[model samples]
Target: MFFKLRKPIFLLLSIPAIALVYIFLRNLSGYSINYQVSSPCACYKCLTDSDPWFNYNISENEFNWWKRLQTESRSFGVYGTTVANFFKIFPRNPDVIQPKPDHCRTCAVVGNSGNLRRSHYGPLIDLHEVVIRMNTGITRGFEKDVGNKTTHRVMYPESAVAVDDNTHFVPFPFKIQDFEWLINASTTGFTGRSYMPVKSKIKTNKDLVMVVNPAFMKYVHEVWLGNKGRYPSTGFMALILALHICDEVNVFGYGADSDGNRSHYWEILTNKGLRTGVHPGSYEYNIIQQLDQQQKIKFYEGLTKKM
Candidate 1:
């Protein structure tokens, strides 16, 4: 009995020593245990995968669920082949690099709500390390309200826009044809018919193109939005994407404008009845509000006009 009690006590005492040695080694390897424990955003658990790049190992169930989110009718085999071809041409590099403990990366997810019209948020928006704009969001002629700096642009074929060589031209591919369009658009120019007319060849640096993972998209839909609407909107996708890549996120130009209109800030509105169409706009906005309430993100509603 004496021997057993002594042995157990000795083993228990060794635990702290072992832990100290492990922590010392981790420090020597430039990994921070404290930062790992303390630095995650409030919704870090919801945001999985440090790298949201395409992989061939996506399961059939995931594919089926994600494909159903869009109106695409391509078979699983065709999707797989297209992804394979895409990787062959484009390097499967991680879009956002692993964050260091010393770095506090801030991001801005700028939407195209008309509320940003005279907000004068340019200087503030440009301060972020990463500025992610989406879907035909132009920075010209409105640089005072919307900053000229665009580090990443989230788009699909229908909402494609031109970005400088420095910007990461991220395509939120909804179908196999979208992948095909990216490949052909960069090389020989796309000629295939899509649901909407897409530019045959967009003037963007092919090397800077990044495709959003279908699995990540599915995660944003099911986990974040609780699978609401037909699928997640590009604005919502960019906001969630910011959560993973940024230590702190500041959102701007979502929801209705100062006049309570849902039109783009860049265009004049004739259709007052226009809504987000297929996306669950109100539900997504609620999620954003929840995140803001939880201090996970800073949502800037912009300036409200006075009567």
Candidate 2:
């Protein structure tokens, strides 16, 4: 009985001793015992439920609904003529958005709000794994405030800009013609007319082009915005896309500037009274603040100085 009790006691005592020795050895080798913990997303389920890109697995109901969305004078063809051709050139699946366990993917969604004019967030923004910029937002003169690095550039045809070879050129298609336009722009040149003066041809690598899913746009309009405005603004859509793809998201250049005027960071405002034409600006601003309050994102309010 004594021998049996002694063996059990010795085994139990050796376990902690072995653990201590292992820790000591790790410390001696300049290795920290710290484990990386990922930040939990509060709305993960909601964000992941809908696929953000058009893929082969898209259900019939979703495809039908997305087809009927009218932007300008065009809608998707009933038999998916443009869509089938689109996948032949562009990738149906976006591999860039895949998440990894060992890596914490941080993203910065940069908008064109004038608030970013003097707010020096360039270095901080560049530190993120993914930096998403939209519309005519430029980094040439304002590289100090807005980082020169860009992972993704989101734009409609009217708001398109030339992106470098490394950056992913994401087109936000509002109508069916937009899909056809992307294919044309990459090949011959998009010479079609629109509500605004669109670039006749865009200069960028075609392989990196990723078109946003129409179903995702409908999801943003109905689920996220509760059918507010004509459709979600490009900036808001970029933010929503970041929320889904990124482990952590930082929002920059949103809302009115310190002067409370709606303007672009790179624009000289001739009309300081200009407001969002079709978007629900006030409602969108409120949702941004609410997300900030909930700790879902880190919202940087730029430039407190009155201009």
Candidate 3:
């Protein structure tokens, strides 16, 4: 009787185990099983080969090459003089301040999606060693959702916001005037004018101001994005930047919300017709999804399943 009972029990337990194996194999069939962590550094050669989406560090020669290309394309403005003058003031790239130490750095790229409102990702996001936020995504009232800590804030001149003293204000300059704007804003509070008016005086640590290289932007557009849309959006640029600086990257609050609308988590949108204009939203989404699937980056899609 003991021998008979043992066989029956073994069969029963083996059923679930066999079923689990089948399920696992089924899911694993099409997926790439090799899980490799991405490197934290970036360079020109690596950008083209391993990951085209990667943003590499730019040299002064590369910067000059890009500017010359832009000049030949007739898209270049008086950027040469403006950038030279601007560098004379600030001189060095602020990214040099935070050198990559001999340790793994986990970074979180936090986007502003309404799905994050109730996801309770604040605690998880704050756990990262480096948290990069973009634009006007504030943490004052939305601390419970977006977290209160910000290590780096990426913004263009138009979307500039006030950051804490400790946070790095990384400016994504699109044109010559944008570079000039940073120098003036840092020192004289903008005595010069441009095509459009920008914030003359920004309240933040001047030393922590890092300007994104225009050459980097060009690389992102032509190489990474394949000149997909009008231009690479701020979020996409920030994502690439994080990949270059952080060993492990976890992306949050990206993609369409639960209702499938492109809206921000911090604001209310009554218009459903509003879409991400001038951006290749669909193409970019597919690329991000591919990155997640490839294990190059970990993407947290903040949506709850309906039971």
On lDDT, the leading prediction is: 1
Using TM-score as the yardstick, the better of models 1 and 2 is 1
lDDT of 3: 0.62
Report backbone clashes per prediction. 0, 0, 0
Model 2: per-residue Cα lDDT over 68-99, one tens digit each? 55534333243265667776776654546555
Compute the lDDT of residue 222 as modeled in candidate 3: 52
lDDT of 3 by residue, 1-307 (tens): 0000000000000111111000111221122223224533331111111212222333355455545432323233355455556656552444432323345667899988777878888989999888999998888788878898899999977788888889888887665556667777777787665555678877777667666665556555554566787677889888877755666788988878778888888899798777878777777777777877766678888872222
Give lDDT for model 1. 0.70
Task: Report the C-alpha lDDT of model 1 over 1-307, residue by residue, as the tens digit.
Answer: 0000010000000111111000011111111111234544443422222222222355577668778766678888888777767766665654464565556678899999988988899889999889999989998899999999999988999889878889988888777788889889888999999777999988787677767766566656655566688788999988867865677789999988777779788899898888987789989988787777766578998864444
Q: Residue 60 error for model 3, in Å?
A: 12
Candidate 2 — what's its lDDT?
A: 0.67
What is each predicted model's overall lDDT from 0 to 1?
Answer: 0.70, 0.67, 0.62
Q: After superposition, how far is residue 75 of candidate 2 from its true place, in Å?
A: 6.1
TM-score of each: 0.81, 0.78, 0.73
How would you order the candidates by TM-score, starting with the best?
A: 1, 2, 3
RMSD of 3: 16.1
Model 3: residues >4 Å from true position, as ranges?
Answer: 1-77, 96-102, 191-197, 304-307
